[model samples]
Target: MSNNHGFARIYEQGDQVNYGRSNVANEERHHTRNAEGYRPKDQNKAMNQMLEENIQDDVAERYKHDPTYRATMHGNEPSKGAKIDAEIQREEEELLRRKQEKTDSLPGKKQ
Candidate 1:
């Protein structure tokens, strides 16, 4: 039975869930490149870059002023001994990898 006002019909239809992307067109759009396989110069690039620069400038300004926030992220800076140990381990690992790698030809750069 259908209601004359169509409110019941709308509620009945809404009960059946129409799930995600199953009905969408199976195609991708190349926003950057045109059909001619050439990238058209984006007018928004400069504007976006300037906005990003402004955001970075704001972040740096905040970071410079907010010592507590900086300390919270890093959680108490490591001691000089710990820093030196970490650096030595990293350099040792890098040297070992270079020496072991067969593909990478260091030639005269090898120690």
Candidate 2:
């Protein structure tokens, strides 16, 4: 068997690799290039926008149908509710961190 370098054997001995021609079709090239001065379209952005719209629709429907939920979610109450939710989330995260620390301190576990 012949010892092969990283180069493709299909090319003749003196054939030059054409760096200029990407071989990507014009249509594909257009799709790959983002517009000048603009960021590339994020795959996750579309999904996130759809998710946000769905969540907003769900929340609006709930506000229309449920008196208690609507009352709690409105202006001043929402702020209070958000504060409580944030506090609860922080406490839960702290508890999780403590548990992780305890587990990490255990014998036979690598830190």
Candidate 3:
């Protein structure tokens, strides 16, 4: 006669447990930090020149046939535009004064 407790045995080889081990697990450390080194002075100057050349080329391409560009490149905007410009400049000056006052009131700054 077999005595069954209706529970499976704890330590059969097929049911053995390996702690902290997984058959399909991947171990990867996914974080890193890296530094970009400085460029030599001559190379830095050459890079700046190349960037300026590209910017000039792009501007020339964009304004090649634009009438507003032709008009403004020579002198002032039309009368209505000039009035709008004056209002914008006034607002800009008011903002600049407020910013200056705020900074002047800070701890080390003098008003």
Candidate 4:
């Protein structure tokens, strides 16, 4: 229910009966004709700041306790994934080194 008066009111005050109160129920839409599109920003600034602080604190607390969340935030892959990548890169380099040695061992004066 809207508590604002004059142009500030968004909903009209009224009374209704539920199924328990009566057999028939009534419904009405409360859209104020003079309601403005914008509201004062300072009205909820303190409340919003507090909520944001609480959320940041919660995230910080979770970062200390949640391994999965920390890993996800740091990178999209696990530590084991990095190790696997390193192994694959090492294998590739070793293969290239062997190929170079074989090429060096080959005896050819002209192509």
Best by lDDT: 2
- lDDT tens string, model 2, 57-91? 88988766444566566544555665566577678
TM, every model:
0.27, 0.31, 0.30, 0.32
Clashing pairs in 3: none
Q: What is candidate 1's lDDT per residue for 7-47, written digit by digit as tens?
A: 23223444522212321111113132222221222222322
Estimate every model's Cα lDDT from 0 to 1: 0.45, 0.50, 0.45, 0.46
Best TM-score goes to which candidate? 4
Q: Local error of candidate 1 at 99, Å?
A: 66
Weakest 10 consecutive residues of candidate 1 by summed lDDT: 19-28
* Residues 1-111 of candidate 4: C-alpha lDDT, one tens digit per residue: 644432222123542211221111111112222112223332233233334455778889977655456567776765776556657767888999999888887888234
RMSD of 3: 28.4
Q: Give the total clashing residue pairs for model 3.
A: 0
Q: Which stretches of candidate 4 lie over 4 Å from their true place?
A: 1-40, 81-111
lDDT of 3 by residue, 1-111 (tens): 443432132224444222121211211111121111223433333333444555677678746534345446668563666556657767888999999888888997654
What is the TM-score of candidate 4? 0.32
From the highest lDDT down, the ranking of the candidates is: 2, 4, 3, 1
lDDT value for model 2: 0.50
Q: State each model's C-alpha RMSD to the native.
A: 19.4, 20.5, 28.4, 21.9
Please list all clashing residue pairs in model 1, or write none if there are none.
none
Model 3 alpha-carbon miss at residue 73, Å: 3.4
lDDT of 2 at 106: 93
Predicted candidate 4, C-alpha RMSD: 21.9
